[model samples]
Target: MTIGATYLGDDRCDFSLWGPTLDQVTLEILTPEPQSHPLGQDDWGYWRTSLDNIPPGTRYQYRLNGDRLRPDPMSRFQPEGVHGPSAVVNQGDFSWQDEAWRGIPLEESIIYELHIGTFTAAGTFEAAISRLADLKALGITTIEIMPVAQFPGDRNWGYDGAYPFAVQNSYGGPDGLRSLVNAAHQAGLAVILDVVYNHFGPEGNYSRDFGPYFTDNYQTPWGGAINFDDAYSHGVRQFVIENALYWLREYHFDGLRLDAIHAIYDGGAKHILAELSDRLTQFNQTATYPRYLIAESDLNDVRIIRPRPDHGLGMDAQWSDDFHHSLHTLLTGEQQGYYEDFGSCQQLATAWRESFVYRWTYSPHRKRFHGSDTRDRPPSQFVICSQNHDQVGNRMLGERLSQLVSFDGLKLAAAATLLNPGIPLLFMGEEYGEDSPFLYFIDHQDADLVEAVRQGRKREFEAFHASGTPPDAASLETLKTSTLKWHKRDSGHHQILLNFYQYLIQRRNTNPAITTGDRQQIQTQYNNESRWFSVHQSQANHSIWAIFNFGETLIQSPPAPNQTWTKTLDSSESIWQGFGPTAPQTLKGSESIKIPPLTVVLYENS
Candidate 1:
């Protein structure tokens, strides 16, 4: 229904609002000289009006019941902050050069997740375009941008989006985002935008005044759940469903990463997640390039990715944190929070072989049997990463893997993620091992809301038994320090790590076994006492072996018996700042090789 101001060209525009609960709606044009127009309501509770002499870029707001003035629920652009007037934007005005881009397949994707504000000091979408070439050179095929939905203030993790449709004004608004997507397409990189549909930010959200946008029947960690099944939920459902399509259609985003689907409570016959996926499926039938919907769910249930016809949500893929948790606990030896459920060579091996360490097993952290088996699910249905925003930034100090693990351990983490069958995602600045903390930051005008957030961040880390208070989320210094240290990529150990990453990504892309994403052709073996693990992926006559030493001592491991092998990459070599390469370049049948402490070695059959 195009809920916001739709520019009709030639100085004419139409304004529409779904305010079923309100008696009257007045459209007040505040820019290009003030004007007022009373809108007419239909049987569906939709207030709409068409006006002449109304041009594009005009600022306007709706006066509900001739009293409370509010921005459009589906505002296309908020030139000012969330509390400011909404601006009219003609989406068709910009000429696009990515008509031929069909997007990369999900199986072929090597995702690089970045926060626009922290990826560069400029913190604008247009400013981020300058670095697309660097990412492409690193063999990254996809860039998953953190949410750009209009949140309060300029600095945030972007999960606190108040306006579902409007682009954040601090990040150069809609035009800036469009330019970045266009540039990314030109660079042969698919763009995936991280979106939050579970809850809106606490500040500057005005949807409640217009209609039943939230439900009290269920509670999320944030507050009330979104009204996906309550009374008068049709409009609310349409509002969010269309919002997902709007990004793919207007901004040219190749996909959307749905944040925290676990909190999106819906008790309807057709779940909201399934309904959204269905709409995307229909859109893709006629789309020039297929768009994807990836979910972030903690349920660890295979139904999230199963086909819709089989009574499932039908998501293209989901973030599998079990893999990350398994790897993190092993490397850092921290068994707090969800980490209590992991920290064993068997779990890591299970994640490598089955993509889920739990899979209906008992979880000591949850004190219940958690997760279901996904043995039949394809490996591409999961997205795995060693470090991401939640894993790094949620800490008291926001320490990155580079800060917690040794240099050799960092290399091993990179090898495990990049060489796995699941789609690998690298957090921004991890390639060169940027040590700057990606602390959570926000800017809200409400003093009470700000205090609540500050207190909440501290309480959240209590499970980790962290000592110091978290850095102030409202501090400009926190935001400034989170920005990637780009110049460090060419210096000392950072450059060495960066080179190692480049080589691994290149091999993953070209290697038949890893690139196939076929779980049936892979095998994993691990020894808990020795703290060594091996993953072997083979296709036809080609094979690759990735062996790891999680212990702090040297271990002897055989690559495979009765076959010759050549060392492709050894993290213990001097080139990687290791002690030196002690293992021979070539090996024969039944030969046990020495693997240095916390090192990763890759081998290809001769």
Candidate 2:
């Protein structure tokens, strides 16, 4: 059923809500003098009303059984706050100018994930729109926006969303988000929104009170698992499906990144993910441009992205934690937590050849036999990243890869990320090496909940034995500290790093072997003692090679392939602030060159 206030015509609106178990719900309009109207309830317990007095831009709420008014679950504009009345927005009022904007394809996507609250100082959609040209020129094809749905307060990471349909009031509400999407399309960039479907935030969530939106049978880390297989699940399923459609249809988002699909517990005859993908496919066939859906899952299950005909959930792609953890541990030599399972250079080599390193193998961190073999899957079906929000924000210190590694180490991470066989994703400020940490922050009102949050945040890092006490997550300063420092991008080593990243991305697009995203086309070799690896890619009579040295002291170079080799990019060049430029050398199968201590080099061989 179509919920929320839908503007019908001049000075008229149709308000509808679904409540199968609630006894009463009255429509309260708070404009042009307050008035209450009785909504007629249907046989299925849906309360609705058509009023000629209510017009667009009107503020209204539903009073439940003489209790306090509650904001609409599917509100389009929460101008005040989640606890306040919702606004009536006219869908057809705004002007759109993206007629010529065809969306970015998933194969060619270089996504830049950014939080609207911390991306810029202004922290508004309109302000963010001003910088799309910069990102478009930086070789990013897609911009993944963190959640913008209205939460409880002005400061949040956006995962604590309460209203599924409403835009956050602090982020300039619905019109602001539309403006950002339209601007992004005009700049030749596709916008992907990160959406949470497992559970709503602890504060201001009224779905449980209205109906069976949650199930007690399964518990999630955040809250009760959303009811997908339990009684009265049809409505619950419809609510989620409609919510996904609402973002794509109304907000004009090109894609959605499903957050924490691992926590979504559904055992029904038809999986909720498969149903969502089918609906997206139906829309993509008729839409102007293709829309994609990505999942952040830890299951390592091939069924999530496999074809529907193969009896698998038909998602477009999923994030690979193995790739990130593999790169992290190999680069830093840190063997704590999940990193305990992945310190070998051989594991990094395996992650590049296969999407997962521990497929059907015993995982020391998981303490169980985990994952299915994903050799048959396409490489583009996995999204790989060296640094992202979770890897950085969830840290006790919220330190980025920049803080933990040397300058040469940072360049190696960037080269491996771009040259690897998968879709690449960069966190905000990652392009320019923004050093500001991406800390976990929230602004909750309840003292008890806030204390619980602080305790939980510290407890998760106890195994790491963090050196310092973590900042209180409830502090608004924590949010402010995470904001990007735009000034750091144009000077010193940061500028050189930025230029090097742009060059790698350019090669990724122009090179045929790198562009193909086929794991079978890549041949990898590594040595754990030497701390070095080589990636050789060949396709359609074209071949290129890249070697990364993770060792600190200069060592004898590994044997180069017997061929006519031409230098493409040498990270040891003085231009990149390395020791010195590598002179052209002849490799007669047994020759060795004294290369820089820690660096990377790319070459083309004929």
Candidate 3:
């Protein structure tokens, strides 16, 4: 059933609310007129009422049990804050110009993830639309936006969303999001929304008052797991599934990025991920463009991406943190916390060729043998990134790669992520090395909740043993400090870094060897003691070799492959603001080459 207000033409509207346990429900129209009407309950505990002459934009609430008033659980728009009335929105009224838009293929996706509130100074969806062309020009084929669901206040990392169906009121509500999606599709960019289904925000969540939306059967890092398998789970399941479809069908999103699937506990015969994936598959049968479901799982489990027929979760793809961890530990030499399991050239090479560094191997962090072999899975099933929100913001100080690593190290990291076999995802400003940190921020109305969040952040960083107090997550200054500086991309070394990123992306797209996405044709080797790693990829008769030196001093490398090679890209070249073109331009058998410190060099068979 369509929960919340559904605007029918001719100034009529139908409102439905799922109040399984309530003895009574009264529709109270708070705007345009003051009126109340009793709703009829069906066999399944859903109350429904239709009103004539109730036009769109009518603000209303539900009087539950004839006493307490609550906003619609599936509110489409919250004109006021989450504590205020929900507005009736006519979703069909918006004009979309994306009839000819077909979504980008998963294999060809170069995603750029951004937080709308921080992407621009205006901090609105419409403001974000002005920068879509900039991303398209940067070779970004897809835009993965952080969650836009309604929260208590405007500032947040989006995980604290409370109303699953309502567009954020502070971010311009439903119409603002629709306009952004429409503009993005017209700009030849596929837009995917990041959704948090594991837990609702601490504040403004009123679903429990209506029904059993959460259960104590299982516990999550946040609190009780969602009631996916408990009593009345059928209704809960449908509510979540319909929300996923609503975004794809109503808003015309290309896909959804499931946030932290590892925390979404479900012990049912049909896992929720598999069920959601099956629904997406069914939707794709007749969809104008394919819709995808990408999962963010830390389990390192291939079953998440494995086919449903094969008894797997059937996610289209999953983020592979092994690649990021390996690259990060190697570049920064950080050996504490989770980074303990990484920091070797061998692991970095393994992640490049195998997609998972801990494939049935011992993990010191977990003190157990973890992960399964993904050799049977294609490389496109994984998404790799050098730096993401979690990696940067989770730190006590929220330092970005531009702040932690040297300029040469940044270039090497970019090349490794872009040229790897898996799909590449770029964080908001990493392409031009934005120095601002992506700190975790939130705006909650409750004073106790604010203190709890501030303390939670401090305790979470205990492992890092970082000095200095973390920026208050509830402060407006923290959000402002996290905003990206757009002008930085056009000046001095930052501009050069931008050029280097463009060149690497172009090579990854046009070059046959790098574009194949074939793991079988790739070979990786590294010397742990020498701190050198090499990836050799080939497709048909075309081949490319990338040699990386993570050491601080120049090192000598053996001869090139049997065939002669011509230099293509050297991160240490003067074009990229490097000191010199230290590596030789051409190489053949019986000739060793000198590699500069903290540099990456590429060669194509001539």
Candidate 4:
């Protein structure tokens, strides 16, 4: 079959797709009654046509060489199912108001990661936008939205998206997304979409029929790897690159969080990531704001965020899993799974000092020497979070850190994250300590696929059997339980946690030492036996010290009697609503201070 198209002044008004192996090629146009265009090429295998009148909203599907009709691989919009007619969408037609919105710098970003389906009661992009002002008021500079690409069902976490270009119809489709992003920009919050390029969903994947989109050479835990380095990979790469640009160019998304770069598996001269980053950079040249890319990688490789000029993939940042693990292990003391490798205060100290554990050290869990020092890199290149979707949702029943740690411990965790050097991120409902579990739930037409998901979850948690079996994936209760309790943000224990988070974020934003660049400028001292640690953040002219006590009993180690320091914040004081700032205390060169049980204290040098 021969592919043909005619260009009129840089715009293609007509295009023809041929499948010689089939019976006929019928052009089913949605406008002016669906019309059939007959095959005009040599042999019925060839189809050709050109029309200048067909404009946007002209939905069409080709009756392949004759019998089967399939949507175009390059379909801009699939309002119907993947098998239905493809609608013409003019991306340039949408009016955008973000001309003055320069993208938020990676360093200054305090991201709030959210899923639309659970973020609000309505579960639509427009509905999610209603909370933009609230999020901005909470000091969130960037909103890292979970994937919005079309998946198989009305409700999903969005990682199983098969229609890479189409926004989920249930979430108000393309127009809803455009409005959401525009509204977010208007509210002074940058939108960063989470994109999955690793694998497609189990159902409704038509890429295999149209071309070789998957490769058997490598496999991800979810499914087969995308064809990134194989023959015909150019088209596949173009498809993904175009999707990335589409979100930024058409929807005005400020950035993207690339889901699972370790599963990308590219063995080519120029990796797909390098090409994608280059294209994004080119687009940024003309765009009003710079676009950014963040990768989710388990490899702990700094190359993921390193620029292409330095022989790296050129992502703007990456989620620091080590930091999360260190914090989680310290707070919960649940040493199951990968957490078995981390628990001591030393682990947290290492994460604070070097930004990664197992950096050049042999990891018993992976059975290899993993990670490298990120000391030379800017702290902004790593996004740190005490609780994220994976950290919460992947649990046996999707329990958050709040479930295991005391209210004081929760405040301490907030202090550690907000005061750290990296970009701080918080999972949805985490700021208020919502008790709902973010379980894995999906609505697939294929019952076998549903059952497979259930079985997979059971096997994944075999090691953590004590955590209890995961909520049944097939139950509607699972999805319902994941929804955020918005009312909790203002009452009871939730209100206390919310206030603590706000105060920590406010302090982080206002203090130069807390938000500084160099990781080397930070110093950490911890006693492994005592289960206590002190983090001192110092710049050329100013310094702030934070002390955390994780033990069960209160301990007094005499205050420093020579050097004077003022208490800026503490988690133990009732007058401060558990957020304390004590009067100035004098300290000697080798003096120590009293630390309460499960409390954190911050001191600023006078």
lDDT of 2: 0.86
Candidate 4, 1-606: lDDT as tens digits: 113232232233556543433445567766646666664544433456777566666677766545667776556566775456677666666688877788787788999999999998888988998899889888889999998777776777889887777788888887889989999998999999999999987777666655578899999988889999987677678778977887787688889999999999999999999999999889888887788999999888988888899998899998889989988888888887788888888989888777788788898777789997786678888899999988888887888877888888888888889989888999988888888888888877688988888888888888566545678876767778888889988888788778788888888877778877877778787877888877777766667777888887665543432335676677788733554433235444456777778888777663
Per residue, candidate 1 scores C-alpha lDDT tens digits across 294-411 of 9999999999999999899999999999999999998999988888898888889899888898889999899999999998798888999999999998888899999999988899
**Tens digits of lDDT, candidate 3, 44-147:** 87899889878889989998998899999889987777899998999899999999999999989999999989999999999999999999899999999999
- TM per model? 0.98, 0.97, 0.98, 0.92
Over 4 Å off, model 1: 559-562
| lDDT winner, 2 or 4 | 2
lDDT of each: 0.90, 0.86, 0.90, 0.79
For model 4, state the Cα shift of residue 271 in Å.
Answer: 1.1
List runs of model 2 lying over 4 Å from the truth. Answer: 43-45, 583-594
**Alpha-carbon runs more than 4 Å astray in model 4:** 1-27, 30-32, 37-50, 466-469, 556-563, 575-590
lDDT of candidate 4 vs native?
A: 0.79
Candidate 1 lands at a TM-score of: 0.98
Better of 2 and 3 by lDDT: 3
Model 3 residue 201 CA deviation in Å? 0.6
